[model samples]
Target: MIYYQWGYYLTKQQILDLYKTWGGKFGRFNPHDLTDIFHARRSIFHYLMPGPVRVWIAGNDAGDGVLFFVGKPNCPIRESVEPDLAERCLAMFGGPPCPFTLVPNTGGEAYIMKRKGKLYKMDLIQFMQSDTKGDQYPLSLDEILPEQMHLLGL
Candidate 1:
């Protein structure tokens, strides 16, 4: 399984700033270590940085303003690691914490979301279908299951 988190609303400069800061502090391989093919990809920039665990931070030059963290495959990001990372990211980016997940090959993957400083888990597919805009805050696993059960009620 691979763990990841997504964040939005950053300029290309901000992304580069993050890469530099993280690379200097924790990167096992620096930006210069990336292959030419990776550098040639103009839309996205990524660097592999290893702290307590390995992670890749990436962003795009497109106006979408998206940045993401990808943990190395088969390595689960520790619980302590994510909150610390998210806190720092929030301090820098000034937005809601994005969803974090351990994506599995089987179905029913759960996404960890933060609302009002409390964390909640929701099924990945349900979150995508209903909360892509994040209107459904403070959601709970029980809430999702019951709604589906109601739909199937006859």
Candidate 2:
């Protein structure tokens, strides 16, 4: 089964303060969104982040750890924090070009792929491989894991 860790750091009150001050660079800031934005964004992206506060899990790629502070209402760090992290997060999980697109065929079933007018129904790595060198390789049941399939809502 596909398992992932989800977590959060700061308290709801702290997140609200950050949203009130720096959420614009996090993307947008609406007074009504002090509670909704983080969860809504997580749902759309399918990333189970550990926070409405500050923390990272499967999807955070900044490499440099993220640290959030309960700064004064309009501190310089607060202004810079979300935007910089937004750019970093976007570039890491997001891909080249859009910096926020679903990178195709990454460690999961791609279903189908298009290339040069032909369709690739298997993973490119699997397709390019040949058994000419050996034939004793064991098979994996990755193709029919029921729990994994259920995750796709199939």
Candidate 3:
């Protein structure tokens, strides 16, 4: 039948790179392209593994989350998504013995807004962390003024 299906999918490296704040405008950009890349399968993954599964769309905040199902029933997960479902999907994929898959979000802008639901965005982890941390490690250099450096060690 050639049915076309597209949903939330991202490589672990893409997720990791976004976590590093390589993206912009709500951390929206391809993670793999960034120099900061984490090695993974580069493909073969979904928040909830495809197959009689449920997919949810969550924002960066706690109370702001929604759900969306992607399997047979095609419903949503509405209880503040935990790894429980992901674990279940893992089990379905042949347990821990089964191999893993990796895929990147590329740029959240395009996919993040797909059929809004009540759950955290896959990139939420990175978005919040970057705001607090500011992408890379904050240089202590900024903490000390130009004159303060020579005086302290001088």
The best candidate in terms of lDDT: 1
Candidate 1 per-residue lDDT, tens place, 1-154, comes to 3555543323334544554444322222223433211221111221221212211223222332223333222334444345555455455446543545543653634445444666544332222111123212232334333334444352
What is the overall TM-score of model 3 with all chains considered together?
Answer: 0.20
Q: Rank order by lDDT, top first?
A: 1, 3, 2
lDDT of 3 by residue, 39-96 (tens): 1111122324433332222333323222222232212332222356546544433332
Alpha-carbon error at 114 in model 2, in Å?
Answer: 47
Q: Arrange candidates by TM-score, descending.
A: 1, 3, 2
- On TM-score, the stronger of 1 and 3 is 1
lDDT of each: 0.35, 0.28, 0.30
Task: Give the per-residue Cα lDDT of candidate 3 at 16.
Answer: 52
Range of the 10 consecutive residues with the lowest summed lDDT in candidate 2 = 62-71
- How displaced is residue 19 in candidate 2, in Å? 1.3
Task: Output the TM-score of candidate 2.
Answer: 0.18
In model 3, which runs have C-alpha deviations exceeding 4 angstroms?
1-14, 18-74, 78-85, 88-154
